[model samples]
Target: MTTLSSATPRVSPWVLSAFWFGTAFHWLLLLLILMPHDVVRFVGEGQKGTYLGVLTAVGAVMALVLPPLIGARSDRSGRRLPYIRLGVGVNLVGLAVMALAASALAGMGGFWVYVLGFLLVQFGNNYATAPYSALIPQLVPPEQRGRYSGVMGLLQAVGQLLGAVTAFAVGLLKLPVLVSFALIALVLLVPALITLRGVREEGGAAVQAPRGPTLTWRQLFAYQPFLWVFVTRVLFALGQYSVQPFLQYYNADVLKQRDATTSTSIMLLCIIVGSIVSALIGGRISDRVGRKPVIYVAGTAMALAALLLLVAPSYPVALALAVFFGLGFGAFTSVDWALGSDAMPSASSYARDMGIWHVAFVAPQLSSAPQGALLDWGNAQGGNLGYTLVFGIAALFFLLGVILVRNVPEMVGRRPLTQPDGNL
Candidate 1:
């Protein structure tokens, strides 16, 4: 049986996972802070949820379409770094456009401009991320993947933490929106540069070229384990998006916080703290006990936390549930990557396959777009019923994810590289 080289040089997991920091930071900052603020500024608080949903849905569509094409292109070219570089450049342009739109344009016109910028951002981010995700499969051995995934989760959580802090400071100090946009650019650029310099493919070479023709759509769909992983991920993302995009509004309308931004940041801080702790622990534990168990526990915790948040009664209770949710989320994210890596059907098509898997993450936003309208309608009926309905649905998604994940067979110690046929 073939095995990866035992003598491969050890690269720091932090260096390997550096770009994830930027990825997590920018998305959290945009979703949790800037987008909500801008939507309200443009559309008014009454219709902010609906407008935000439309914008996110549009952006999500762009995100869904770009990555697979870009990934496939990179796979055919047998190069990933150039795409990453190109993506970063494009992402910065989007940020600049968004800043100008928000500052110069006004009302719905500005919103439309902002949407154009956002679509560019999605295109660039996904272009980078699809190839970037292949690094673990290319670099790390099967035995070490769980630990590497843990590091990824840790960095992602920390990025989110920093994003929350930035949001808090921006709100407290009344910092200009451009400052926040500049920070986003900085966060994305620095870590991406680090990853570009610090990481390398096997023996400092490009990815191996495919020996056979690429899988057809029918062949791809026939890959059962990969499909299971995709389905499970879609369900999990559904749970996450159902709540994440509307959190600031939730604080304002449900908790009645005078400072909704600060409250939302505080809640995110709790989630980040819990995530940091669990990410460090969960990835390593999965290496020992297998991915499914960790996912089971993590999914259950998240579902319960979402349920608890439904009747949280006060800000403090919501904060506590956020931590619990974070713990689950962190563990799930860490193990989730490892699981996806394990289920990869083709070693040569790593980027392309990973990009398809990534769609699971963004596709949920399409389904979740309705949530914004659902929230509005429920709130219109009084008793903060929208919050209850959304949170309940989130919990259901989480629970379903936990149950459906059982269909994916565990393949933790089995290395995909060993199988020339690309069958796990």
Candidate 2:
């Protein structure tokens, strides 16, 4: 048994495997069971963008409010497995609901049924997410967190990539839409049950550390590093989504790809494959060399690559640029997650603090949500303006990211576990 505190011990391989299983299940469901495909069929043609935005905005809102509260509750309860168990159950059922709604597409279903199902999937995702993520800091010490976070990142990219393929397969199968949800549910349950088996909680209620600062985030964030890093992440999320949500549209409308679906399938596969390699390699490298140096390189590389995509005349060149961007994006993303883990002043409320950190990812939706408006604004100005302008905007964020990464203080160096906050 591996122990973090004097109270109880946590071990690996089992816990980590469990994490991967749940990760695969979650993304698989999103692409195949819940997202895209059928829900939009119900939206009147003209209002599809508005409806999708509403869907995204709703999830963003939940992302902002719920995760921190759930984290705090887990801290208060001094338990992680119970939360994980409950989360897995809800996630399975939510996928089941979404499958039902998807199969009903073009059938006698009403709009409300689709809306209800999407909401179920999204809301349940939040419920499961908040607690599950909170468990990471509790389990892994900082030295190993880079490798661990990288592995999780790899799982995420692969899971989502496969999920999209699977969803497309379902599209081919002409299977009842509900079967898609059943697939998601099965994937979610299998690993979740395996996860439950080996996940014994660490730490004793009797030996809790002297509680760290109870200061509200407003007060705590007065420290510059937190504010600065958070801002950088926000910018990255804004720029990232600005390009991503519309990539299919951009390919179809702008690139004039003869087969948009085939092209997108190829592009996503390449990007995800690159992301997996980058995460695995970058995490280990940063741990050895330090985090900031990698961030600087990633930011610059991605900035340049984004511009290359904007100007590429042919699909092959554009895809090449995407692979370039993926390398930089993956490096930064792997290290960035590790960096977030290192920056925490308190691991006692690991989820709460991590939630605050991740708000950088989620809150940017408010600004980036108007990607359509930004694209429209660019189109009015003409001459490949939207992609050009958006890529430039994303590049600027990467540039700012370089500046923000300069002096990140860490709780531990990447090679050894150290608790600067004295929680252990």
Candidate 3:
């Protein structure tokens, strides 16, 4: 039988920060690329949302199954590196395939190749993220998780800024789209490589053996607090995801802006700024008060932002709304993981639990495609009613998200794994 440490050793501050930076950079880079701008460019205006949504939905199906299974396997074996390394290899290959597909569609378009490429990217990245997030509980002591989460939020802000800047730079240089994407891959890979090399988990010396009866889906979801978190997340995520991919399209198609890229970039820039401020403060605040209150505040702020967008007359007004939304989202991002860490059903199944929790984000993608179809449907009816309706629904979801978490217990500023320690 293998022996494992009772307590997880805390990771050094600098190394953990660098790891966060690398992970954020990689994720933000992918998000920027997958935004509506690229999709509309290839698939055309009328169908871009639906096409992108469809592709995302299709890919999400694969992502839904893979992460949890992989995370569970890692839990059993007491290793994340091997899986993470495999993810990196898969991700690189997926990016290469995507670049090739994008190149082929330089003229009119080709759907299947691009779809396949995207699916592979989803599979690779989601595989990596499960293990990546699982590291948080291992690295940060529970008392300081809020602070660590804050730092992560700051890195995420920086990464968002970097991703937007890179996108603008690619456009300004007028590089071939495929080449631009390739450059992004290179940029993300640098820090990822560093993270892989530099950050090492403790307890590798003694591998963990699975303890107790096997975890089951039914038993896992039965944990009420986790269920509440998942429900709130899925609702808010649906609202947020439904709106994001449509922003650029709404600007160019409905608002009729020739400089759509610049406009979009400005809004994104504002979001980055807002996220930076909240991320720095929100996590620390949650530590003192509680995660639920912070999330409530964040959700309300986001709802207000959505309402403002629904009524805004011009791009400038929309820009202002973006800032508010960013602030809210930034705060939520900072505290959410800390809360998840607190609410985990089992320490042994951290990665697996996180993987299941990830479905809140993933399931929303499936709705996004249908939401796009809804947008197209609304436009067909005239008066841009579709956009208005969608924004309202988004706001409603945010509001409901705030309310749903009201009853869930808070776990801020408490030690993690109080129940028992596993080999991991």
- Overall lDDT per candidate, in order of appearance: 0.85, 0.62, 0.73
Cα lDDT tens digits for candidate 3, 362-388: 888788778888888888789887888
Put down candidate 1 lDDT per residue, 1-424, tens digits, no spaces: 1111222325678997889999899999988899898888888878887888888898899889888888788777777788899999999999999988988758788888899899889888988988887777656767778998999999999999999999999999999889999999999999999999986554553344324235654666577778889999999999999999999999998889999989999999999999998997999999999999999999999999989987888999999999999999999988878888887766667788889988999889986569999999999999999889998999999999999999988878775544455333
Winner on lDDT (1 vs 3):
1
Clashing pairs for predicted structure model 3, backbone only: none
Evaluation by lDDT, superior candidate among 2 and 3: 3
Find the candidate with the highest TM-score and give its number. Answer: 1
Off by over 4 Å in 3: 1-9, 17-23, 26-29, 32-35, 106-109, 202-214, 413-424
Q: Where does candidate 3 have its weakest 10-residue lDDT segment?
A: 415-424
| Candidate 1: segments with Cα more than 4 A from true spot | 1-10, 201-213, 417-424
Of models 1 and 3, which has the larger TM-score?
1
Query: After best superposition, candidate 3 residue 182: deviation in angstroms?
Result: 2.0
Q: What is the alpha-carbon lDDT of model 1 when measured against the actual structure?
A: 0.85
